[model samples]
Target: MTDATLSRADPIHYQDATTLAALIRKKEVSSREVVQAHLDRIAAVNPKINAVVTLMAEDALRAADAADKAVAQGAVLGPLHGVPFSIKDALDTAGVPTQRGSKLFAGRIPTADATAVARFKAAGGIALMKSNLPEFSAWTETDNLVTGRTNNPWNLDRTPGGSSGGESAAIAAGMSPIGIGSDVAISVRGPAAFTGIAALKATQGRVPFTGHYPAVTKRWWHVGAMARSVGDVALGYSILKGPDGIDGYAVHPREADAGADHIPGRLRIGWVAEAAFGPVDPEIAAAVASAAARLADLGHDVEPVDLPFLGNPLGALMTLVFGEIVPTIKALAAGREGDLHAIGAGIVATPDPTFAAYLEAEAQGEALRSAFAGFFERYDVLLTPVNPMTATPHGAQELVVDGKTVPWTHVMAATSPFNLTGLPALSVPYAFSSEHLPIGIQLVGKWLDEATLLRLGAMLDRKGGLDERRPAL
Candidate 1:
């Protein structure tokens, strides 16, 4: 195809993997051509966005060639065959720099791919690059000493959201069709919400965490997909779900497909209008109310729900995340502290603990999990603002929402409880703020009930047509 034809007619850059696969099957486009279009787009757009920090240009081309050859032989193609995708730098990719957005592991390369990455390759997805993340995958904003910060494509002055912020920005800017991102708290959903993309934080352990840096053994971590649409998230999840022998936490016996059938008509949705732990920005609260109104307009039953156990769970979660850093901090700092990140360096510099604090965190987490179970018994799904405000300016550490200064962790308060509960949650774009910044409302479901949440998200997507609205980059 000529460059003009590729630029104008190529569906690969903007289309989801499922749509691209069908086009490939019809010979409307070749896998090699489609992959090349994405590579060209990446080369063109990535410098401004700083989304894909590590490029696999040659490897991506080789894989695309292989995919084209398979098609030429009439070979079976997976759902994501020849589709270009990116992974958060926190996930391992064999022979690639999988630096977890830290200077400490500046040149660290992995010998094997993370289980989720392996699954994507097995499903015929091509890895175009590795996206950016927070240092050690610890923070919500995607900035570090290694590769600098990833800017939001919508407005470069604002952040994309993190630690999966890079992936969300890349997908939103059409840098890649879909990308893999992990959610410790709101990493995936928050970024997706901010960038006007789609993301799913699967029930914990649904996708393996093996080969992830700063290895998460405590405070349940989940690997999920960031994409432009709900259907794409479902397609990616289907490919990445299942056991890999290496990750003990990888789900065994397989998870039943949780796509969209679980959504019911006249659904009862519990709406939390305010931040459970802190005050929400008025615009964000209005966005949530607008989404709830949309659901009500569709005849879904929407009612206010109060979560009294929020503060304790968040406090316990912080203790858990910060407590894990103590060891890493000591090791890195060698008992000397400078900044908080340096204190983190000291924790890493310290010796490994024989009796770790993870156990205590786990114990507290169990109580919080029980509280969420009781809460879910009364609500089919919970709707809350994904972030208290719209996208914050890049380099913003503390935000003043309603005249109260709040730390970045508060951004995850409305979303993280579900992570601790091992429940499924999705961030769906609700409406744009008066500033034209995107605002999203999260739909959270009971444990292992992602299908219900996704169905509701799809219903919202259809009703609101949010996907069609894009920031003019």
Candidate 2:
């Protein structure tokens, strides 16, 4: 499609956070006015996209008034003061329903905010709404009995990607300035890529996951920011990072240098063209390759690298995820047969696995982690496809990758391994496919070294100029 067509089809939503904050700081716009603008935008576009499942209009107006008060009093303002943001429905918001896209807990509301939500509020962010997610945040497509499905803002027939799909869809449609999304796997990255937005999955534990449903008992789960710009992600991360007294898994003696920013220079970037893992969708691969070439043009040294360990990253991830699931199911089910979600019911109906089999899967995961560690030794950043394909149509619970009728879990293969290894990764829009859907490229970085990745991503963001293209909604 022509640039003009894409522009008219899906308009970019939300101004840059920095710019918006500055306007608030300057009194050019009242905090209430800013919040209302977003609220109105959501009302205008959300019905077409269905990304936002819950609105907090009253709470947001109150917070906006407080933000305006702080500015009037000359009170020290947080970096995100008066900025409007959103969270995936899976993240808890006190008093606001967090259905988690599951009928299991349709009206559930938390008594407290998720760690990331608290941080965002503490930074003076106004939480306007909650975005959609897959049922129990387990699927790649955002659909559940509670909130229904979220359509791609660019095209109603296509998906927005999930379990963070709602956030991606909302951001892409200009409903929210920035959003909070969790990544146990590709939930954040995949959706961001599919929707052509920017997202970062900080090294696991960088952001506390406490208070999120499906309680992030696994240390590999991550909470990060999603936005239209890298700088906004950085600003959101700055506010959201650090320890909450409640989460023992939260990173301590934080090694991240908060003030440091990535400076461009000659750097080593590992480009994974192919591996035994499977074939990448040709269009997706081309987008990644094009991104690599753009990085090379920006003076970085890019080379193709081998990632043999990822041959069965999905298998390892399934073992790890299902290992956690078995117990969660038992607890959520509470011995009540047929009470569980359909997918959960299917999972439990299968006969219990032999202990030997469980042990073998765990062993395989450990081995895969070891290989990723070795791979990182030779590469500062690893660039690959976020998903083997672009966003699939809404309601597709399963995807066919490389002729294998894989479960939704395969969508997270490229991402979950990094989560397992505790590495940082970012998903940036690369190019559009033959069908005109956005394709995303993944950039994985060393553990806790998001600065380098963000810097490289910023350069790519500048060079690829995907930001210049907006979807018509």
Candidate 3:
């Protein structure tokens, strides 16, 4: 690429994947130019943010060239043709190191791409790099023995939330236009909120978890999309959604419709600032209320929702997840426990769950889902805070919310319920805190109704006024 080409494509790195694809298809910019621009941006900014752990510069450029050739030949293009996207290191990418931020899997490369990665590639997107994550992708913050920590591009001293932290940081920093991240509870949404990006954790089965780490039978786990814009999240989710023949749990009962015309003129939106979601920070609560008011002004039926049964499920989630964690660590470590990361060590030290407790947690999950089902029957969407607070300082194990100190894990309060209920949820930056950190609001939709979340998210994305600001990186 020439200096002129690099200069021209520089701003393209920040454009959403959907726009990039359209530009490529129209021959306004070459795929190589797009890929190289991102590679350059990653090289320039990643050391400061440390989001990308393994970059596939050569392979990506080669793929970009092939995409340009296809366009030159006038071949029909996929919706994401010529786009560059990152993958959370937790997801497998064939022939590329798929280390899930643990030394145990360091340098390990898979022979086949994770279904999500394969779908992106199949749609003509380039695998730009592998983003960082907590070891085994089990922590709420992105730090690991394998690749160290991924800092928030917005504030280097703070974390970018995990286990999708790196993916969000990369997108927020304009290193990659879009990427895929796994979410058992809050991985995708938490990171997106922390980094001022947009992400969607579709209903659990909407996307297959076939090649993600911690290959467990946890029904609450999900694989989803993280992008700088809701439009990109919508596009990426559409490509990643549908069942892969291998993952029996992955099935889409209905196709997604993100078209503006498909959305109703008015939606019944129920919002909750606190109560069931634990003690939310005042700023976060205000952001949720602001989003609700914006929707109300747009002629939607907006009301504060109170559901006693919809309590924070993070405790139950821990009971189920930690119960599996001990065994999963032992099996994956395979007598190499001494070499496991600190998080893995901590997990192993935690007491195993009794059969009764595990069963009770399962029942709690079932009840949570049942409650959400009934609530959705009354409301088209539920609005809440994505986290109790904005991004926290690196290594912070506790957080103070509304004058009370709570364990850092409480950040998952608003997010884990939807995971347990298997509902689609969107996280989009709504406002900034006094500290200038981005605060996000969560939009939860009925199961298999990501289209609704995406549609409403588009509305919020436009009015949130966050699109005008990029991290001062």
Q: What is every candidate's alpha-carbon RMSD to the true fold? A: 3.9, 3.9, 3.2
Clashing pairs in 3: none
Best by lDDT: 3
CA lDDT of each candidate?
A: 0.77, 0.77, 0.86
Backbone clashes, each candidate: 20, 6, 0
For model 3, residues 1-473, the per-residue Cα lDDT tens digits are: 11222233348787778778888888889999999989999988998999989989999998999999999999999988989999999889989999888889889989999999999989988999999999888898999998898999999999999989999999999999999998888999999999898899988788988888777744878888898778889889889988888887876644644333434668888999777676888888888889999999988999998879965488888888888878878777878888777888888778889999999988999999998889977888899999899999998888888999998888898898888778889998778888888888999988778888887888888366564577887
Model 2 ranges with Cα > 4 A deviation: 1-13, 255-264, 334-341, 397-409, 465-467
In candidate 1, stretches whose alpha carbon ends up further than 4 angstroms from where it belongs are 1-11, 257-263, 275-277, 332-363, 462-469
The sequence of per-residue lDDT tens digits that candidate 1 reaches over residues 336-444 is: 3443353246345545433455576677788888887887777778888888888898767688987889876678878877777778888876667777777777898
TM-score of candidate 1 against the unseen true structure: 0.90
TM-scores of the candidates are 0.90, 0.91, 0.95
Which scores better on TM-score, 1 or 3? 3
lDDT of 3: 0.86
Using TM-score as the measure, which candidate wins? Answer: 3
**Residue 364 displacement (Å), model 3:** 0.8
For residue 188, model 2's alpha carbon misses the true position, in angstroms, by 0.4
